[model samples]
Target: MKILPFVALTATLFSSGAAFATEQTVTLNVANATCELCGPIVKGSLSKVSGVLDVQISEADGAAIAKVRFEDSRTNVPALITATTNAGYPSRIVQ
Candidate 1:
């Protein structure tokens, strides 16, 4: 079976020096993300998210990845999806 891809919320946690943590991950298959032209759009969209520190879009792979580091208390995965959708590329929250 072919499971649908999750375009957002690929959060990863890393230890911070003091009391901070980072959830950085790769989201896949934003349906509208196609062609080389979609790269910038995807990246720009993901970058607008509050927790996201950076974004990387691969047109060849149809992937929109977000590097997010949130306050753990502030937001959660679903918010990430909303951010991408707000930018016009609605996405799923990958596990």
Candidate 2:
């Protein structure tokens, strides 16, 4: 019946909506990235996270700034921070 088809269509639309991933980017101020070698280490740490898409590292004021892009549904700020901390670099959200 026409009503049954419409119901099926509506259900399909709603169900598929959940499959879309929400992406987010955050800048973290990383501490203990004093040496030049620290950039690669921080980048590697962030990259190891499951949902992290990309990571770029730069230095400012003797600390490292990590710009990270990740899938929000798969990970979050806390996970990112933990990744860096576990890698021996402590970090905080840049605001």
Candidate 3:
């Protein structure tokens, strides 16, 4: 009986890979965010994406830096890039 329970636990852990999903944070460069209105638009777009947990935009010079946290299983860096670009903000991963 003890051996059977241990085998079942091991199998369960391997079967649902997504259950171990982790959060990821990325910084993006928003090149066109030179004005006050730009930050809100960029933030709104990022906030609307599914699995996006948080978004923070900081402006400096003529650009905006966006830090975003999201669940890796539901979204990714490419999706984040697309969101801002579609909003007319035009962003790229910082690294």
Best by lDDT: 2
Candidate 2 per-residue lDDT over residues 14-68, each given as its tens digit: 7865467788999999999999999999999999999899999999987999999
TM-score of each: 0.54, 0.81, 0.81
**Tens-digit lDDT track for model 1 on 1-95?**
23323322222222332236445564545667666666677676666666665555544355554444443344565776676677777777556
The 0-to-1 C-alpha lDDT of every candidate, in the order given, reads: 0.57, 0.93, 0.93
Q: Residues 1-95, candidate 3, lDDT per residue (tens digit)?
A: 77999999888987867677799999999988999999999999999999899999999789999999999988999999999999988888889
- Evaluate residue 19 in candidate 3 and report its C-alpha lDDT on the 0 to 100 scale: 78
lDDT order, best first, reads: 2, 3, 1
Tell me which residue pairs clash in candidate 1: none
Off by over 4 Å in 1: 1-20, 60-74
User: What's the CA error at residue 2 for candidate 1, in Å?
Assistant: 63
